[model samples]
Target: MNIKQYLDSTYLKTAQQANLTEMENTKVVQHFIQEAIDEDFKLIMIRPDHVKLANDMILKHKSKVLIGTVIDFPNGNSDLEPKLQQAQTAINDHADELDFVINYEAFKNGEITLIKTEIIACAKLALSNKKNIKFIIEVAALSNHQIIQICALIKNTIIANFKEENFANIFVKSSTGFYTTINNLPNGATLETIILMLENSNPLPVKAAGGVRNIDDALTMIQLGVKRIGTSVAKTIADGHVSNENY
Candidate 1:
């Protein structure tokens, strides 16, 4: 397999941490877009504001690298209206895919209906726009049973409301790489969690995100039937280097 084709090289940092200003961040995003083009990776995920910057660069170079953006990132606590607005903005900026953070807190609180509504709304909006959607469940924050339950909820909801063919465009991603832990747990995708997600999310692809640091681990994820790998070190993995930068 061409490992680069399965990699979604990701960088979701905001301006203050990523650079001195938004303009500098655009330059950094442009560099990322060029790297994705050169490496021929499947996608490059960035914050919504830089989606246009990425799209502009990709078009300028006549590259096939897809542009993806994160919505309700790290926290799924945003209300539905704002989330929809943000997603619309990303769409207008030419994002090809959108990864949304699901409201696990609501699910854990027995608010299943609320979680379902939020996901359906976001998924429908993106799917209607011909953009792919991946819901980040933040696997590190839940138990194994919770993981299975959340995935099943999403799977069942999608099949009920959306056409079966649209399943290929939706995913249950492993993590957002930005959740607080009870005892300082590892905050990225784990093998056992990925397996659980893969088994539970039928028909829909599973994206292993967060802590993938090397080619060997990435290959392991692919071997487990994972359709996509999201990481800060995708280039390093494709080039056979071990990545130390933790997303």
Candidate 2:
């Protein structure tokens, strides 16, 4: 596995605070972000409030630093209007991509039409800025069968929408940090989910996240067809042995 490609393809997230006085904590977070980018990370995801700081770093480094902002992050409990507002705000702040969580309960409740409508609305919001959208499925919450069904359903629906909208990519993502069970696995079901999605998707990219802590793990997920990794452990992974390795 090529380490540089994996590093460059990842979307690293940092701890973010909502205000300027929280500068110290933001600086600490940015430090790790800088180290990862120095080692060749091309994208970074952060909370909306930290966009200014991240933008500053992106300008300073003269690197291809893509800024991604989460919409209804970790959990997808917000109403459609609020989520759209968040997406618009992130775009207004210059986010290159939007990581939006799908409202799974709506889908499982047989609200497929409604779910599609919501996704379309979000997709349109993102498209208005010529920004890309990655839908987080939170794979740990579903059975394997359910996961496949969701993948097929969304791939058919959302990818078509992206095509009709003339955007290049509509991504399917697995697990947000909200699912702690994945954290317990020796190696997560990240690769497994990506494999399933790839087998089922048309051209949508897959983001395999949650507990991806080292080079081997990241590369393994990538080999299984993941185009992006959402993580905070890039430095540790990029530097260490990545096998029987100590962080």
Q: State the lDDT of candidate 1 residue by residue for 1-247, as single tens digits.
A: 8999899998887778765698877677777888898999999999988888898889988989999999988788888888899999999999999999998888889999999999899999999999999999999888999999999999999999999889999999998887777776778899999999999998999999988899999999999999999998888999888977765
TM-score of each: 0.96, 0.83
Worst 10 residues of 2 by lDDT: 9-18
Which model scores highest in TM-score?
Answer: 1
lDDT per residue (tens digit) for residues 12-62 in model 2: 333342243456666665875586567666567677776667777877888
The alpha-carbon lDDT assigned to residue 51 of candidate 2 equals 64
Task: For candidate 1, give the lDDT.
Answer: 0.90
TM-score, prediction 2:
0.83
lDDT: which candidate is best? 1
Model 1 TM-score is: 0.96
Report the lDDT of model 2 for residue 112.
84
